[model samples]
Target: MLKNIKTESFYDLCIEESLFLEENVEESLKYLYEHGYRTIAINQSINDDNLGAQKKSKGSNKKVKNSEVPPPIDLSPLIETVDKLNLRGFQIFNRLTITYSNSETFNKFIKSNHYKKYHLIAIIPTTPEAHNYACSSAVEADIYSYNPENKFTARLTRKMYNKIVQHGYYFELQYSHAIEDSTKRKNLIHVSHMYHSTGKSKNVFFSSGAKNLNLIRNPYDILSLGFLFGLNELQCKSCVQHTPQQVIIHSVGRRHGKALFFVENVEETQENDHNDLSNCEPQKKKIKMIVDADVET
Candidate 1:
């Protein structure tokens, strides 16, 4: 249901002040881990955590002349915390929408000392018009629009995808419908869901785009989404195990403070393994245990 189905789970979109708040941090990671997500592509200007300082800065200013004045906010701390999370990866946009200061600002930011260890997850602009300035050298470029009905997201996706396919450049459609519509834009890997709230988004956990980006209970979510997509028992089981090995590999990388093991078993394979494990010898100090975890560990 959720496996290799949706294109993208662009979860990290929020105001800078709201992004790195303690509660949001715990919620985001917990959601990722619980849903078996291994990949996270942090977006620019979203998921920011500088609300407190922004408020203080605003309070300090009594008179405001320019209506176009930017919000008063300090983004240093949010940047620091994101750097420390050891996240799978995050995106970098050269020119953010509010300022739209041209690609030069974005180019400098990408090379600046501030974003050294953090890899570029994606480069998304507010609309398709902005994609021109977003370079092909950036990891990937996302053309964003809030309205699901917008034609810019759809049309530019096709044009950019065609131009960049040979270069391995891909598009991540934001606020778009199930991308099953665009067969030609196969490189556009991920798709965002229409669901806005948590409960409405229960189906997102099971979607498959990139492995690490999935929400954990995602396997179960996939099972349900599978039903919607008309899959069967064997197909569903295969779906569950589609990337089991990959998940295990990433879990190990996190050094999650737990010993990890990988066991592959089919009906016949399990029977053979069971017999071999059962027949293993037990020493005086080490008791042979049939429980897989006890013995395997």
Candidate 2:
């Protein structure tokens, strides 16, 4: 849908080493960016542990002890790779799972790169502490990908969602299952099945994952995500604009030059249309102070 509409750029979060292995890092990122990919998110995956364990374990009786725990993951490797991403810049950094007790260690890895400037979007489980952490941290986050089948999960998830937004963080929610006739092509809205099944409210507050968005056949489906969040046509157009003009006007004291330009245009047109007709002729410029004041003798 985005391709058909010729959407200029996309923010790709959670890119993997597999992508780099399958295609060379420089080539892959360049190709994607040249073809309208804008941002890349370097995130550690939840399945990394499984993959690493499988790679290390070959013998049947091989067992790892708790005392000999693996060292903390250092993200310096990914940060180095980022330096070579010439075309696709990273807008956000993310950690795939915050479920581990040592997620703070991972957070430390990201914070270590103080020189880097980007939004950190870590995953947060549906827990009170997790919710509080996301709200308090300068880093923003989204709900962790998990089953929301039970009432407890839903309630906690909802609380986390509210907390993230209240703290001025944007979040994304994914559906565990598909809904029938839920996504309409005309408007391209993805209604939440969980919300519908649980008799909860359904709207554009939820966003389907990038994988789901790619499968959509309608152009509107891609754009409706923004529209659902109350973006009108002009605002939407401005969002897509190549270079948007920004203006800062002081409400109390300073006159806005841009506003005055239009105001002057209107006044000039109005004066031309309705002339002062007491003289029944074109008005002359009266130098108010000079002409009205007689020389005192």
Candidate 3:
């Protein structure tokens, strides 16, 4: 038997790891829920520099184990709190965001089982080669995110954007930094313009990327903010609702094959089979015998 997994209607996919460390994290979640975010992903960012350091410390020849990657934060306690609060259908998913300058190191990280623990995998390529490799190569990832605070070093051409969209990857635009600082807002808009020029803002979605509770905004506000990112009303709406849902579905499919449902085999007991047979009455069949005779003709 196959079944569909239930996902919440609204999502704010990029809540930062710092927010989870706060003393009032539960309160923060409550506020977000109140604001109508039913699903949220806590993002843990890893840089290629850190991976290189670990590789150097362990010797370059040795295969890096799962321990080399930063483990996902324990969300059990937060889940319990949410349960106690009676937040129905609320979902918290773990996300791994790798910012890589080197494609080899990125490949090695993705090859490890540790990276699979996350519900969503996002990559931020710092160099042109890394960016091209990420887009063109058969990398296992769900989202392509960029740092709004920093200027993009990698060239984002039209073909690259098209390839990314064709690969079923969503480009994330974090709104929190835009809300926090003018300089970051400018940089964020510049990046958004790039998306607009290259791809006409296709396959783009909005995430909070919120460091604290204060940075979080309602979905409607995010919809309006989407306009500044070159998204029209319908496209803006999709960024918050339809596109995020598709991103989650894509991540699920990435981890668990392309099938919408998992298959399970159910065995029938002999007694049940006998009972089923007993309910049916047997019918007698009459057969007419045909005699073929090569007559005198």
Q: Quick one: best TM-score, which candidate?
A: 3
Cα TM-score per model = 0.35, 0.38, 0.82
Per-residue lDDT for 29-72 in model 1, tens only? 54554454543433334211233345467864222212222333
In order, candidate lDDTs are 0.34, 0.34, 0.80
lDDT of 2 by residue, 81-106 (tens): 65666433432233343332234433
The ten-residue window of minimal lDDT in model 3 covers: 288-297
lDDT by residue for model 3 over 25-88, one digit each (tens)? 7787789899999888999988877766777788854465565458888888888889989998
Give model 1 RMSD, 1 decimal. Answer: 15.0
Candidate 1 lowest-lDDT run of ten: 195-204
Which regions in candidate 1 have their CA more than 4 angstroms from the true location? 1-20, 23-28, 41-102, 127-129, 135-154, 157-159, 173-297
Error of 3 at 160 (Å): 1.6
Report the Cα lDDT for residue 174, model 1: 31
lDDT of 2: 0.34
